[model samples]
Target: MAAAARLAWVDATSGVAGDMLLGALIDAGASLPAIRAAVESVIPAAVALSVDEVSRAGLRAARLRVEPLIESPPHRTWRSIRALIEDAELPEPVRDRALAVFGRLAQAEGRVHGVSADEVHFHEVGAWDSIADVVGVCAALHSLGISRLSASAVALGSGRVRTAHGEIPVPVPAVLELSAGWQVVSGGAGELATPTGLALVTALASECGALPPMSLESTGVGAGTRDTPGRPNVVRVVVGTPVAEGGRDELVLEANVDDLDPRLWPGVLAALLAEGASDAWLVPILMKKGRPAHTLCVLAPVERAAALREAMFRETSTIGVRETAVRKTALERTWVHVPLLGATVPVKVAHRDGEILQATPEFDDVAALARKLGMPVRTVLEAAVAAAVDQHLIPGAELP
Candidate 1:
């Protein structure tokens, strides 16, 4: 409930691979025995998880390997996959968490393949090894007891890939589909990216942009199985205590433009966004004269003060802009796994008095699950909330 007490960032600047990402998490201190125990509980047949130190692009990392009891099979529908994960006799917490991951993957497959959740079979995600990777990673992440996860813009390699479906162009269709709402980059020398990697990012990353400024702490590099002549083939994970509370700080910058043209306002706002201002807007008012004017307001971090102030000056006829420091009360929020409306979604819980106060499904989580189940996001949100309320897990009350 306190969010594992650590912040994690995945440096996918060079790209992310399933195994590489799993290895990176392990390197970042995800327990191997805990992961194995979790996996064994979820999988019926006996499977062995092997971890070893390995190198990729000269960076050291842990390589996760799985020895499954059955031969790998072809694509499987979400229903089958869910059956496997649920039937694994896994602990309630692990089972619930693992189900959320599969539910996300299932929804993605359903969307990409144009089939129902029960009908959509996974090509890469269904493989035993991939299952171990995905579930194992989630188990490890949960074990880390971390509250928030962030990632840099993903680096997707350029070039075609041979899949069970056939040769597809670079940035495979599934990968492209999974990255629908997130920012991604391409042009690696080799096939350093995959659909599974992108899906994992899409499902878990809270934000997909540059690394926010934070105090440096522990770093773990997950090595991929490829070796290129140049850049290292590794995924790095950085876990630390955020220097800034919630990695957010408050600052307000304002400028009055009485002599500016009306047409210039739109451009100025866009410029602020391009410069990375958290928020920028205009407030209409009457200036010294009984005339009309606009107060250009910009809310951003202190770091963007110089650039934002410069933008206002360059764009408007304002003589100067004033900067003020302000305190903001932010909710200490964390995400919870909830089953709702025939799917599992991440419910963000904000609380006080050790009592349940506010709970809402993450929009992306609801949207993704909704799109997969062919149901409206609102319906799922309602159902999830209702379920939480009924389970007496809503924070304050006992089950009726």
Candidate 2:
């Protein structure tokens, strides 16, 4: 089985172009020789694939330049594009990947032009060079062993773009239609997004929102050609392992109880956390009878539903607590060994978009210390985290 891989799109806060993205990916560690071979394998021998190091927005990036294969347009129909991918002597997997990206593009174009998928023609992306870029990306990813892809909101520019159909409104109907449900933002008032880019992203990217928190292993910076102010003219592709194990929708147990002792809240929460609940908390509330109450909420993973209910009954004096399964997207997480305060303790790591966003020392680690030193577990955990941060042993944010 292939390793689980994820691709996250960086905001490009400034802008992104084809060459820039290719460059950025190369910079992030996509093998240049492999990328070149992938492109060569798909295109006619006449087309030259040129990749050179170039600086954009004061950052060095690999610039991918594709020499045009034909002086005139292919005017390639969807069928022809599909056939080219099918007929190409590329590997079966590569051909299948190419067809998938093209198929998605065709569907988006069909939607934009109010035609059936079979009737839409890819005027811009059907160009020979475009084919190389799209196919090369797929091939590079396959070579990198990546199977999953995602992006931050895509930096799709706003303004007019001159195409075969003359000047059309910015974002081009096809790109806009394809990027549905994905976060897309305007940048530098240029044509930052291409139909091929949108289609590739929409088809390959598994998630289209913010970079999910992740422990970043490496990053690839793909450089675009345009020089825009205030934003890096490159796309940052992040690759890393997802930390999440399997999780399911949870029941949120909530109840407002005015008569319970406030001191019981802490123990209740701890018990819930110990009983497999994902998270537990309390909020101050004013009941209808004008009595002050604490609204306790418990978010329990599916398997712990009964345990959470039993705890509520045992800990709180409420006759009933509302319960319902609520779906949530959470980062895959794991624990790592980090030395802090003269000891190596396990630290919890959370990731999204392939970057480590949060790292906290395990409470059990602190509790162990507390037992050894006769101190509170919270104090030990906090001090250990602080020491880890002060010594630059742990990442940002102390234990919470």
For model 2 the TM-score comes to: 0.58
Best by lDDT: 1
lDDT score, candidate 1, position 81: 71
- TM-score of every candidate: 0.60, 0.58
Q: Which ten residues in a row have the lowest lDDT in candidate 1?
A: 391-400
lDDT of 2: 0.68
Task: List residue ranges in candidate 1 displaced over 4 A.
Answer: 1-3, 87-97, 213-216, 246-400
